[model samples]
Target: MEYVASLAFAKEKDQQDPLNKFREHFYFPQRNGKDAIYLCGNSLGLQPKNVKAAIEQELTDWQQCAVEGYWAAKNPWLYYQQYCSKPLGAILGASQQELTVMNTLTVNLHLMMLSFYRPNKQRFKVLMEAGAFPSDQYAVETQVKFHGFDPESAIIEVSPRPGEHLIRLEDILEIITKESDSLALVLFGGINYYTGQFFDIPAITAAAHKAGAYAGFDLAHVAGNIPVELHNWEVDFAVWCSYKYLNGGPGAVGGAFVHEKHASNRDFVRLGGWWGNEESARFKMEKGFVPKKEAEGWQQSTAQVFNMVSLKASLELFEAAGIGALRSKSEGVTNYLEFLLQQLNGINFQIITPKNCNERGAQLSLLFLDKGKEIHQRMTDAGIIVDWREPGVIRVSPAPLYNSYQDVFHFYEIIANIASNA
Candidate 1:
């Protein structure tokens, strides 16, 4: 596990990487006619090499079949979304019955809350971290307001200790216990986008249950970045975007999860469409809505065949590499990034991400006290494609599927030189 700060060391590791060939599977952004060191997979992933072909195939289908593509296309438009279940379910640790590809991340969260966040006079509050992604914070706030409660009274934000970067697990458990009587739901991000804290979902879910609340997650930064057992953890619901670690192209179709325990609850309130109705009676053009037997019942519209084409291409890489093997490689890449980062001289930045391997994914969020934006700009000019968060944080994520150890070393070199110059 000893890591060295040299190109040779990185090259050696890259040579040994089983996932090295995957780097070729993606088309990285070009910088001076070479691949840029793209560490922003946490934001938007590099496009898969096959994405064009995948999209073209769908375009061809649409052209050739006209209105008949609904059933005549290679992957029938009638049930096109079903194509994702096997590959993606494996990563989610879910049965295909529990998960379904549908709307974007926030849209699915809104839909899930409609069913799960059933608050009463006695229990109407939602509990979550203080700094959840802004969209999630807004969603919970508006949902509470729509139910005729003030957000100030209905939302409880559990905060970190004044000097600490991460929220304590004990603090979360204690708050859930204290607010048990008033908590209608407990929603949290699977990983905080800024700090990259991978939450203890199983523990949090169990605690939420004990506190008599439904537990759910917005897995924008965690899904596909790490292996999560939404089914085994008994997560009531979860949602994720496909463009980040899943390596789907920008604005890709996202997905949702609902536990099997909710499978038979046909009477629950849902905003439905004909696509969600059972397939047998769908074409009958009946007046009443008869929903499907599983999570697919939550679909509000027909599958967006074009939107999912790129996602299907990306999942093929995951299926080929396997999640377990990818996670192992990801740990190595991030740890090496950390090791090399610490070796830089005169750098005044703190890595806010959890140091414990189990508490993080591939991202390392650096809060810089010196030359923050300048350093970020310099890194960008040097062809290191990382992202800078508001205030003074830079997020670096070496995605195992496409990023190589040599890419990590080059990024380190750029930063080290910048620090030394400063």
Candidate 2:
């Protein structure tokens, strides 16, 4: 797909985009009264215009019905979470009973770990990618300590071979084969936050199961950015935050998936709470806990009605646009950005993201040979919003919902000019 180098080309592409009309649904930020070229959806997504109305409905119910609003609201706050399950399941390619919207990412990780991470004397080790998001690392470390094991001795960190930027499929398989005797779980991020490399989830999951280890994923960066089949992949469990590519506002509710195979396993240990109790008997205030038979059995508290409302608003948009269509546009947008960056050869800038679109989402990590932070600051001053990671990586994500081809073009133009001037 050849692209023309002109504003007219961008306008033409926008005109042809079936999803372009959806951009008007968001409140884009402006700098000095002009719309800023926002490209940092990987960090925090722009708020949807409908979010205000969604939140207002909840407030209205709270004011009108008081305590009765829990069962009397328009959507019925008692059952509000049900509104999220089908749509989210569709987005995740999972069955409705296999998923649920619940606590934040790290909190959900702890809850899932309470049930899945069953370590013993022989099988007491947890395996994970070396450069996973810091929150996941902390969660795993804390879980290991809770189980009376030293993290250094009980946790296995997998890294790419020396001098390599990405992990090879064979290396992961080899580790699983050699360490299966002591490994209890294999936890990994669906996509690496820094390098933007998407791991082969199916292959990894198969290897883990073959070696008698449970598999899970932290999809903070992958959810809504790429297509995932958690149920079909036979992954034992997974958790993800909705704030990133899901466009659910900042710190929104995260979700979890428990394979149906484990849904009826009463022997699996979990931290019990009223919310996870059998829904029919929850209000009875029974002395004993009878856990629900589905994924909702993992919840520890009542739903956050307000945060879930924002998530519902964003999910309605996703339902209309469809993940397949969104991913199609994402590939084209990110590939074009990569092409433009490569055009600036010998400018001391390089893209660390994988070359294959199948192996990455919308983010491209740029490593500047000199003055990375200065260039990032210049781009910010130029009305382009990109996120800077530590050391020397600037992450630019062109979200399919709100970003246009013009956004990518303008971003490249600013970076190219900065490199030349430097």
Candidate 3:
């Protein structure tokens, strides 16, 4: 496809897009009385137009049905998690039986680690990417300490080579091999938050299996941004937040996946709650904890009906758009963004994200030589919503759901303007 940097060309592309109608489903932030170009879906997504109605329905159910709303509401608050299953299954590439909507990402991470990160004396080390999100770092650190192991010794971080932003696949595989003897678990973010590099899940999973270790991922950035086959990849477990690419509202309910082999195993050890008990037995309130014979078995509490309603509203859009189609459009638009950024001659910055579309999602991380914050502020002032990280990187995420080709062009225009002024 020939790329053009003009606004007219952008409008042409958007005009021809089948998913273009999706942009209307979200309510973008207003700036100067106009819709702002929101590219911050990698942080918090723009709210879906249906969210208000979704919340209201729940409120109505609570008012009309009171305690009986669990069974009486239109959505049945007792089974609210079920409403999200089909769409989340498609987005995360796992079967409904292998998936569950639950607590936030880090809490789910801790639960999965407790179930899968069993570190014995001979094989007690956990391998993860260096510079993972702080929550993951903190969770792994505390989990190691809770298990009475020195974090410095029990946690092994694989870092990129000197002066490189991306962690190479070979390096990850090599480290797993080198630490095979003592490695108990291999955990990574499906896509690194800072670099936006999409890690090779199948390859990593195979390597961990070959090394006799369990493989897992925090799919905070990967779940809705790209297609993944967690079950096919034989990923032992995975977790994600809904607010990012999933377009759930702020602090939306999180999701988790457990491979069928483990999800169906009646004896799989996990912290259990009444909601996870067999439905038939739940009302009995007995002593024995018999978990559901699937991913819901990991649930530790009743569904957060209000916390999950927004995600339920958002998933309807995903079901209509399809993750596969979204990924296809993502590759094309993200490529256009890269092409336009490359045409900028005035900026002293390098794209730190992997160049290959297959190795990344919808984000581009601009590593500026200087004035990173200044340029980020310039973009904000120009009504282009993007994110900035420390150490000179600004994250521009063009979410395929709501962002248009025009949005990319305008983002390029703002950056080019900033560069020209400098």
* Per-residue lDDT over 149-255 for candidate 1, one digit per residue giving the tens place of the 0 to 100 score: 98999999988999998999999999999999999999999999999999999999999999999999999898789999999999999999999999777888999
How accurate locally, in lDDT, is each candidate?
0.92, 0.88, 0.93
What TM-score would you give candidate 1 relative to the actual structure?
Answer: 0.99
| Tens-digit per-residue lDDT, 1-422, candidate 3 | 89998999999999998999999999989987999988889999889999999999999999999999999999998888989977788888889999999999999999999999888899999999998999999999999999999999999999999999899999999999999999999999999999999999999999999999999999999989999999889999999999999988889999999999999998988988998999999999889999999999999899999999999999999999999999999998999999999999877899999999999999999999898898889889999889899988999999999999999998888878888998
- Residue by residue across 336-415, what tens digits does model 2's lDDT show? 88877877744676788899999899999987768788888988888888899887888999999888888888877777
State candidate 3's TM-score: 0.99
Q: Predict model 3's lDDT versus the native.
A: 0.93
Ordered by lDDT, highest first, the candidates read: 3, 1, 2
Off by over 4 Å in 2: none
- Comparing 1 with 2 on TM-score, the higher-scoring candidate is 1
TM-score of each: 0.99, 0.98, 0.99
* Candidate 1: clashing pairs of residues: none
